[model samples]
Target chain A: MAHAHESNTKRIWIVFGILSVVTIVEVILGIIKPESLMASVLGMKILNWIFIILTIVKAYYIAWSFMHLEGERGSFKWSIVLPLLILIPYLAFILLVEGNYIYDVYSESFVSWDF
Target chain B: MEATVNTQTEEENVWGGGNQPLGASYGKMMMWFFIVSDALTFSGFLVAYGFSRYKFIDSWPIADEVFTHFPFLHGVEAPMYYVALMTFILIFSSVTMVLAVDAGHQMKQKKVAWYMLFTIIGGLVFVGSQAWEWATFIRGDYGAVELRSGRILQFVDAQTGKRIALDEFAQPIEDERVVHLERNGVWYQSGEGLPSYTVNEIKAGFMANENVVGRAEKLNEDGEKIMLSREETAERLESAVHVVEGANLVRNEYGNRLFADFFFFITGFHGFHVFSGVVINVIIFFNVILGTYDRRKNYEMVEKVGLYWHFVDLVWVFVFTFFYLV
Candidate 1:
């Protein structure tokens, strides 16, 4: 218990620092909004890249620090987090593609459909 | 504990075969599983929101305009500030909770009590702020058109895509249509009318006023209103009451009704958690004051609640990111 307390203090500060740094990166990227990268990426915009990356980083910190997964056993940590990592990404991919597909339908094709 | 569990054996146990690793208590383990499920639930919601956003990529409501409110600063155009403050308060409470748990370990009841008090206060403040936010959202800033099909059309200036209020283009309520005879809805339920005006009434008034045009929700290539612009939107809102009939779903002023519904449900759920956390903290605070845990020689109860408090903070982190920052 003593060990846990001592380590938790150190861990909290370390996590706080990491969180602050990630936040700064997000702000910088948000403000810059550079168009060169945004121009094209396999037809996906660069802004999407920034959003995805930052979101992933935030998700990582939440799982690792907030969850205390880092302190848990390797197998235990993997069992919980890895499953989510595997699933969330897949869900994101499918949904984003499907979303773009739907958007095309609504913006372009929806008008053609009669009531 | 391990020996006892092992001795109890598989015969006596249906739960986990009486074996568990990591030394986490039953309560904590269950909390973990519950949180995992809850996290997935939130992910599904956010992902669905994203999917819908992708479907209407160009025309979906901009988040900035939808969430602009700060205390005592009516119509100042301050966006995301209130939510940002709410985020900070939650984080600060997390810090205090950890401190309380730290003091709990050291057997300092007084320190634990003080820290826990601060945490409770923080949670209360968060709930209060959320209520204010909900009120602003429900009241809606700019009234819009409700179409028969349930989509929304916002009035905007013909030139600029900026949203126009019905009042701006709409004429005053016709006394002839006033089924009322008094200032308030007294005497008979003939009704003074809806407290907030609707789009249809504005449309009726717009026929009376000149230069006001109704615009569908979609924007043109220049990111301006496709049909209505600032002047027309303003004109309709100036004289209208209630909301556009079926158009209630796509409130021009508030964006999509689904957005508001989700906002209320999501943040309301979170606020409920915060409120309950505060209540639990209060109970523990009393227990601490009464020396219950102190006498027990272990403040694990406090530590357990701290875990929950921290979890609440963690959830808010994601909520803020997706709902505001993104």
Candidate 2:
């Protein structure tokens, strides 16, 4: 359990650089919002997908390096990460799909919402 | 009861108190449990935000247009710049926190104290930035008209395609209008403060200015706010009931009320977390200075707090992606 003899400062700086670079890329992409990527690929813009993917990468790196999950036993890491990995996406999917259905209903109804 | 003698070997006793499940200390395991539950709570909030956003997908305000202001830049249309900076500050702070934990592992008390101080400072800055962001969002720029159906109608230059503030063209009218205070009308029910311009003033202004057109909340094929034709603009203006200047629980100058609701709730909640994290970091910072952990020969307290700090940073990454970037 004692890591007093070894140095992890180099690895820490490298991860920080990686996270910063990814964030800068995300910001740049967001500002430019290239027309080609803005086109909807599967109900969402391709650019949005890129942002989400990059954000997940950043999240993973933070967890693995900063939180020291990478140094922990495999079972411990999985125990902490796997549940969120399964449940969050499932929850997002259900809410978004149902929300879209409700939107369709509003659009089709005779309420004349001044769209 | 046979004095409750142990019958099973340690290897066979899954619930044995002597064993560290998953090789984690009891404190670390409990922290993970708490983190998991807290993560689910945040996920619930984000999913609800997604649901509301999807339901009003077409009429949702463009995040870029709303969050364009930076601290020093007065009129520049720099979208996502300030948020990006905030993200960097948070991630860098997380780095500092890990450094503190590493130093703690090495029993370097002074280094841990300095790194923890940096982390606390970073957290305070991030929290302050979030407060500024909330203030900016609440006090909106370029006011809009709220229709009877609770829809917001903004104005844009017909030729330039740039948003125009109501103050630029609204012609003030001299009328015997008295603002109803708590002492005047319905003693128990006080009236809201008068908007900068009346709907009539806005309508008259729109009619007089040929260069200005009304933009509806809905988006068109190119992902731009749908602009109404001159005739449609006139028709829509007829339904305007009140002037919406900024955002609140009841109304938002930005298209949907739900957007403001989610924005306040989620970001406010996250800001609260950061605030508490700073407070905790400060407490730990003092402990490190007092050599409490140094005497104990372990700085696991710093490591524990570091885990929490990293979690906060992790959550912000998702919030930035979903709320701003996407």
- Cα lDDT of all candidates, in order? 0.67, 0.89
TM-score of each: 0.79, 0.94
Superposed model 1: Cα runs more than 4 Å off:
A1-4, A7-11, A17-45, A107-115, B1-20, B159-161, B176-201, B204-215, B219-252
How many steric clashes does model 1 contain?
Answer: 36
Runs off by more than 4 Å, candidate 2? A2-5, B1-16, B176-189
Best by lDDT: 2
Q: Could you say which candidate leads in DockQ?
A: 2
Residues B135-199, candidate 1, lDDT per residue (tens digit)? 77766666665544445656555455455666666555554343455576557664434534544
- Provide per-model DockQ scores: 0.40, 0.77
Where is model 1 chain B poorest over a 10-residue stretch in terms of lDDT? Answer: B244-253
- Looking at candidate 2, what is the lDDT of residue B43? 92
Candidate 2 per-residue C-alpha lDDT over B2-120 given as tens digits, one digit per residue, 9 for 90 to 100: 11232333356767577555667888878877888999999999999999999988888899999999998989888899999999999999999999999988889999999999999
